[model samples]
Target chain A: MANKIFLVIQREYLARVKKRSFLLATLITPLIFPTILGLFLWVGMSDTVGENRKVIEVVDENNSFFLESNELYSFSYSELGQEDAKLLVQEGLRFGFLYIPKLDIQNPKGIVFYSEETPPISMITNLEASLQSKMESLRLQASGIDPLLLSAFKTNVDIQSIIVSEAGGERISNSVVNYAIGFLAGILIYTFIFVYGNQVMQGVIEEKSSRIIEILVSSLKPFQLMMGKIIGIGAVGLTQFLIWILLIGLVSSLVMGYFGMKMPQQQMLEMSAQQGLFPADGNPEIVEILQMIQGLDFVQITLTFLIYFVGGYLLYGAFFAAIGAAVDSPSDAQQFMFPVTIPLLVAYMGLFIFVLDDPNSNVSFWLSIIPFTSPVAMMGRVSFGVPWHHLALSISLLVAGFLSTAWLAGKIYRIGILVHGSKVNYKVLWKWLKQN
Target chain B: MEILSIRSLNKSYGSHVALKDFDLSVSKGKIFGLLGPNGAGKTTLIRIVNQIIDKDSGEIYINGQALKMDHVRNIGYLPEERGLYKGMKVKEQLLYFAQIKGLRKQDAKQKITNWLEKLNLSQWKDKKIQDLSKGMAQKVQFIATVIHRPDLLILDEPFSGFDPVNAEIIKNEILELRNQGVTIVLSTHRMESVELLCDEIAMINRSKKILDGTIQTIKEEAKTNVFRVKMIPDSMEYVPMGEELRRQDGMLEFKLELKDQKPNELLGMLMSKGEILGFEEIVPSIEEIFIQKINESHGE
Candidate 1:
């Protein structure tokens, strides 16, 4: 029996691996992530490379005050009249020409500026302020008023955030890591269920509808067949996913190294900004994200995530395999699949809401501990510092749930594989489970 | 000893009965034909024997012991429905099925090679099933069914796609297996093949066994008391036997119904007439018997 099952697994692996579609899908899949990332980067950087925007002309007609130098903006004297300067600016001779027109000895209102496009508001405001300050200082010196009072009014300060734990112990904030952990956890759970669950369903449908499953189940027990299919397909999925991760990592490093781009550091900083995307207000989400990333019980979270991912995949994959066996065609499988999938989907939606509101809430904790929902919920709690004991409890519960659901699904699979020539409704399926 | 005996089997699909009180027995080395028309529950009985499906109420004995799960290993079944995995190579599929039938890897490989060579499938062993033609695939399916050299072979429509030459080859192989003491339950609608091949037959129609016996006995049971008499001209018009007579193509042709009359009476009449060209008793073919039995049962 074991050898038969091994042969089945081998057949499943080789058959799928040899297909043109599978090869294309697997090999082409990794290229997609990097290609999409590169395209996005290309579109964003297309307009900015090797282009400088700050150009300024300083009149300095009387050399009353030499224009203070700046790196971003260049200073040049206006050699032409205002109209000619305006034409020069329009014709790309310069960004703009600044003329310190003949001013009244005290009022200083006669200044001219000319440009095609409007200058950046910050640059325009800064230039205007600086010009005014120089003029005022010059006027003040001429009028003989003291500048000592204004110098005494200036001071600068930087603030840091601190958080107090439940026991009133203060710690430096790690908000960015917390949110990063949550986001990564949620994304991983979502991806595993979707990818592996669909694979199980497609495998079952292919075998069942093609009428080869009867031959398969004859050699291996139904449960053996189901388990082997799930494991084999899961292995294929994991292999493909790991390959994708490696390829993306390789391409990203190459792109970053060759282009002299600092994407990883930028990504870390952007992770902090991503708290805004989560919509937490005045809560120091950056510190929370960082703390979650750093202070998370790594061993507990890793074990729990692995357990939940495999458990959730098996729990859903059983039903997917059952659906595959129960229906005669893919279209028919779709009808049955929706009802089974919705719970997982609802768990996901609930996890999203729970994570955003209270990542460690009772609802999130209980749901994550349930095998079907654990993949999403436990990952959510991992982002919010789940205790080791609770994580262990959740993993245990998921395992229990996985085993029971597998039993139920195997019952259905046994009956559904032999049934043909009729539509199997929920009621009929329920009866088949009881009788078979 | 009989290799398989399905005694009074009964089965149903929901309320629509597929098999009712169907009995089949195959002696150790005989090729047993299971003749039936479409929807005659031949497949249902075959499945039950294979343990692929269950018989609601019956006892199936294999090798003089009641059939059990382990008995499945002794019976090789080729279902009418094609069961090969289309994506798998022919050799891989053959080996996989051989393992399912309880062959060790080394044995399965050796046997698979032997069967592949025997069936002239050596070149196509590495080709996927989907790449083969229907006949080629059928040959592969045939090899899969018998690769383990099972004691009892249950083949449903085994010759479905084969042309005469290929069919003859398969028929010879089946006979060879039978010669080696494999009891075969061959199901098909092809009565000609049944007549040429089967020693005993049990036929079902409308979920009931309509006939069961050795081919010779069933043909005798279905025989009408008629004999054809052929003679050159100058025959007596009257005869002691029942009358059904006609002449054509410069010969006298007539049917003598011998209800309680001896066949020699017809010979006597022909001999009394002009020199008898030919005279013989006509035995009904299995084909005619099947048609007649079904028509009589249906009142068609």
Candidate 2:
């Protein structure tokens, strides 16, 4: 019996793996994110392709202030009227023209930027900052206060978040990193179950609709067939997922290397260090980030993920298989699919709302413990640190849930696989379930 | 030796009784026809034997041993609604089924090649089932069914989707397999094929077996003892020692009461009246017997 199931699994796996669609999907899926990211970065960087400098015509009616020019924008002070400067911009000669009317330094008004197109906010802010600083230093001089002393007193403060463990070890915790990891893991589980679980369903439906189930069931039991197909397709999903992870990591690094762009982690570390958030002795933030990652209990989370991934898939996969057997065609499956997918949808929503927002909340706890939702929801909670007892209880319940669902679905599948040309409903399925 | 035996088998779906007290015994190397009208529980009986479904109450024995899951390895079933994986190549599909039936990988590969060649489907081995013509696919399904060299083969309406030429080829293959000591249980509504092949038969109607026996024995038991006799052109209108049923083409047909007199004595009496041109006893076909038995049971 076990050998037969293995043969079925082998057939299922080999058939899917050999398909062009599977190969295309598996190969392209990992490249999609990186390729899109690279495309966007290319587009963003190419925006600097035009004239290397911006020529801003400054018309200061006060005639007492002089503006400086930088590499990005060159200031052209002119006694010419504002109307003439606007014409130069309209004729595409100047990038933009700034008109600063004479005003009280205490309360400036009617300070307008006149141009054919709206100037970028950064250019406008630079102009405003330059003028404001000059005005401030003049005011300090008039009040007999030293401008250099006041400038020396200015300081930028940085707040650091450090997690002090019970073991007297300090680790920096980045909320953005935690949120990203949890979110991605949760979504991955959700997508895996949805995508691969449907593959299991479609496989069963294909076998059933094509009448191959008749030959299949004659040699092997229906439960064995169901389990074999579920496991087979689940393995396919896992293979694709692992490949995607490895390929995405490899491809992104290669692309970044080609462009001489630093890794995002290194960039973040360098930026924080330049801001004096970390001491120059050693990059403690990088070390702390790594420690915090290690302290997240990935071994437990990953092991639970695999267990729940299979468990949730089996639990839902049995019903999907049963649904496949019960219907005559793919369209007929729609009516039965709603109820089967409800728990998965709920788990997905709960992951975003309850688990992500507050992983230790009662809603998250209940959702994670329930077998149908646990596969996704528990992964969400695991990244945020799940209690050992909750993880144990959830895994145990998921196993039990799979067995019972398998039993129930086996009954329906046994009868449904043989029957054709009738509109089977819940009543008929109930009757089948009760039969020997 | 009996290859398969079932006693007092019963099965039901919900409140609908599909089979009641069904008993059958198929001897080795013989074609056993399971005859029934639509919804007459033929599929139910076949499924029970194949272990595709469970029996509520019964005992089934294969080679004098109680039926077990492992026995499926020794039995091949081609269901009425038969098909192969449409997206799978013929060779791979056949090999998969062979392995599922407990053949080793090398053995399955060998058997697949042999069956493909034997069925004249070697060229189509690498082609997907969807690409094959309906008749060609049917041939592939037949090969898949028998590739494992099962001891007992059960086919339900195996010829439903085949053309006459393909049907003849399959019929010949079935006979060839039977010649190799394979016990075959054929369930179909095509009585002509039944007549051409079946050594013994059991007719089912409304969830019960109404009649069963060798084809000849059932015909003999249901005979009216009628005979057709043709006389010379110039002959007396002499009557035999029986009731005259009809006269056609210079032939005289009559029904005799064998209870009172022997067939030899009746022939002697007829010989004295006219030159015996033709004399033959008429036997009922299985089709007629089936309809009669079913009508009888329905009436009861």
Among these predictions, the greatest TM-score belongs to 2
> Which one wins on lDDT?
2
Estimate, for each residue in B182-267, the C-alpha lDDT of model 2 and write its tens digit. 99999998899999999999999889999998998999898877776665434646666567777777777665555566778867
Location of the lowest summed lDDT over 10 successive residues in candidate 1 chain B: B235-244
**Over 4 Å off, model 2:** A47-159, A164-170, A264-298, B233-259
Fnat per candidate: 0.33, 0.88
In CAPRI terms, where does candidate 2 land? high
Candidate 1 chain A lDDT trough over 10 residues, lowest sum: A286-295
- lDDT of all predictions: 0.75, 0.84
Question: For model 1, how does the per-residue alpha-carbon lDDT over B1-300 read when each residue is reduced to its tens digit?
Answer: 788887888998778899987777788899999989999999888877776666789888998899776776787887776567787899888887887778888999999889989888899999988899877887888898888888989888988867777788899999999888898889999998898889999878889888889988887777777777767756344443445476666667677667665778657755866767767677888888888889888984
Model 1 misses residue A284 by how many Å? Answer: 14
Per-residue lDDT for A1-436 in model 1, tens only? 5765676677667666667887787778777877787778776676454256456777665467556656557677756667777777788978887888767648777676777887778877877888878777678777886666655765765354464556676544344555666667667767777777777877887777666766655455778788888877776766776777787777877766665675544544665687744344534554354443444457766666666767778777788888877887777876787766777777778776876467667787777676677777677667455666777787777778778878888888877887776889889888877864
